[model samples]
Every structure is written in C-alpha cells, then in structure tokens.
Target: MGRRTLVAVARPDGRYDCRIAHWGVGADPIAQSRPLGTGLTASAARTVIDATYDQLVVLDGAVRTYVVCWLDPTLSDLDDVVLARTADPDAFRRWWVERKDEACRALDSDGCDPATVRRALLTSLRNRASSVHCLDDASFLRGDR
Candidate 1:
C-alpha cells in the first residue's frame, strides 16, 4: 500500500483548526492547527473544512463540539485531505445549512464573503477529478506458426 496522508479539523476551544498526518509504514502523523481566517464564521469555516475531507468525526467536550476531518492521501487527494466534523454529522449539517444565508450575507457585506470562499472550495473540489487512460500493448499476442 502507498503512503496515505491525513488531515483533521477540530474545534478545541470554540475555534476552528486543522491538522495533517501521513499514514504509512513508520509514517508519523503531522498535525497542525489552522486559522479560520478573518470574517469567517464558525459555521462557514466548518463547511469549508467539511468539503475537503473524506470522513468526519465529531466529539462532545465540556462546552463545545469537536469537528475532525480524516483523510488517506494514498487513496485520496493529498492537498485536498480534510478533517471536518469529527463529532456529529447531523449537527454539522444543520449548522452548515443554517449558515448558508449568513455566509452569503457576509459575502455581500464588504464585496467578499463566506459564500465566495465556499464557491472557491466547491470549485477546488470539482477540479480535483482524476482519470485513467490505457494505451495499446502487445502483451496479449502469442507466437503463430
């Protein structure tokens, strides 16, 4: 099996962050915290992060929900790996759905908004298509008398 890279998104203290790790023989997981950036709401950040990861795991803590996005790059996009909702998918979905309007509003606020970010994210997802092509070969040919 090839090396796999993993990315995680977690909210430790009411703030959104992301981490990345490599999965393979003797591979060490590299985790890091990501900034939600300015003008991005928690819901918007979650949505963006969710779209990047293959699986999400949610955990309940003292006063907040932890959203984790896990990815295996050997079978997925290395740069596109994500750790989105690591606790509750239902809650994350609801939060993202409700915040769509707010994200749009934010986009219109200062000529830039979360919707723009969302759209960019969508585009990135759409652009990551992979295709396979095969060429003619003579491996199937046998000697004829």
Candidate 2:
C-alpha cells in the first residue's frame, strides 16, 4: 500500500463512521456518513470497522475495473469481480463486443453456453435497478456519463 486509506472508522463511543480518507493526509472528505451501530464493545466496533472497510474496497474495485474496461482494451483479466460491477445490459454488451473473442474462448473452456449466459447476465442487470424512474437508461450505458 502506498498510503493508508480509511473508509470506515471505529469511534471510541461505540459507533462507526464511514468516510473517504485523503491519501497520506488525516482528513477525510466524506460524501455521507451514518452511525454503524450503538452500544457496541471495543472489539465489536473493531469488527464492524474491518468489515465495512472490506466492503468499500470491493465496491470501489469493481467500479474502477468496469470503467477501465469501457475506456481501454483490457491488459488485465476482467474477472467476476470486475464483471459484477457492470449492472447495465447495454454497457455490458458493449464490453462483451470489445472482448468477444476472449470471452468466448473463456466460456468454451469453462463448458458454459455463451448464449445462455449472455441472456442470464442481461436479465440480472435489468433486475438490479429501475432505469425508468432512477435515471435515463442511456446514461447507464454511456460510460462517460
């Protein structure tokens, strides 16, 4: 690690706060925060802090990995961790087009049917959010937005 990043912190009074750590600096520029819990012991607060930090890391990793795939030809393997972040079908299909040959090869090696998996992934993304009320369907597909 280059510098410490604290996503969620354990407070002495038995609650946790989630904040974004400024790299190499102590101040955190937080978007929002809420108390993790109340009436917790020191060890329990520590456990909550650790778990919340891990979750934040995974969420951020997935987001960046997906964005990179959209912007460039991937040099790294786009594993399940990255793929899970692409919750929009149009965006994901675009990603699929960029690496079709590679993806197909992988699918074949795993003995999975490409057509079936493609449909499944599309359905899953569709089920994730209400694009009609939440945001424009096109915006989700457009990575630059």
Candidate 3:
C-alpha cells in the first residue's frame, strides 16, 4: 500500500488557526490551528508539534487562499507544505478529492468526501501526536512527482 495522507484546513487570521474539515476518524476534540511565531513559545510549539499530523491545510479567509503542510517521515523531518494561490473553487475541490482518494487507499479505508476525509485526517494526526511517518507533498501536488 502507499503512504497515508491527512489534511487540515485553516482560515487566515494573520495566524494559522486551521479547522479540521475532514479527519479519517471520529469527531470529538475537533481540530485547531497553531500560530507560527517566536521560539519563546517552544512549549506552545511543542504542543502543536506534539499534535502534528501527516499533512495540514490552511485557508486564508481574508485572501480566500489555501496552504498545505506535511511531515514526510521519509525525509527525516517535517518540511514546509505550500500550495499555489488559486481562486477557482472547482480546481481546489478537485484537488482535494484526488488527494483524499489517495489517502484513503493508503490507509486501506473507503474513500470519502473531501470534507469528511479532511476532518478524519486531522483527527488521526492528533491521535498520532507526531509528524507523518513518510509523505511526499511534491508528489502529491504534481500527481506524478
């Protein structure tokens, strides 16, 4: 099987506070966003790091944009996950679906909607409490990288 993928979405507030749109599990604690700031908040960053998932997706409300991040275990550490600026809702929707499908297959589960899977992924990531074991964001983005 392939590597499982998880995604989380956050609305822009000049800070990263993403919501779990679809997680591959039950919805209890839900998903929350963490801000990227100074190192003084190492403890807080630790909390976020402790809650790290395989992949995270943030949406900027003001700019109405989306950004993605992921931890590739294959790489030995978490790398920045970024998405190009897109205004087309359909394009984003399609992209979400494709990735969600691949993720489901990797996890050996039935494929679900973008929102459902997104929420589930977020939940799964929280439960794991570690960066994704092995993920390649570039490959996921290009569909062939």
Instruction: Tell me the number of clashing residue pairs for each predicted model.
Output: 14, 0, 18
Query: In model 2, which range of ten residues has the least summed lDDT?
Result: 64-73
- Tell me the lDDT of candidate 2: 0.33
**What tens digits encode model 3's per-residue C-alpha lDDT throughout 87-113?**
443354355446545665644454345
Better of 1 and 2 by lDDT: 2
Instruction: Assess every candidate by TM-score.
Output: 0.24, 0.22, 0.24
**Candidate 3, which ten residues in sequence have the lowest lDDT sum?**
136-145
Candidate 1 lDDT at 124 equals: 35
For candidate 2, lDDT tens digit of each residue in 45-109?
Answer: 23332211211211121221121121112223222212223334345445544554455555667
Q: Once all C-alphas are superposed, what RMSD does model 1 give against the true structure?
A: 20.3
List residue ranges in candidate 2 displaced over 4 A.
1-110, 132-145
Ranking by lDDT: 3, 2, 1
Candidate 1 lDDT by residue in tens digits, 31-73: 2222234333345444443323333222222212222222221
**Stretches of model 1 off by over 4 angstroms after superposition:** 1-81, 113-145
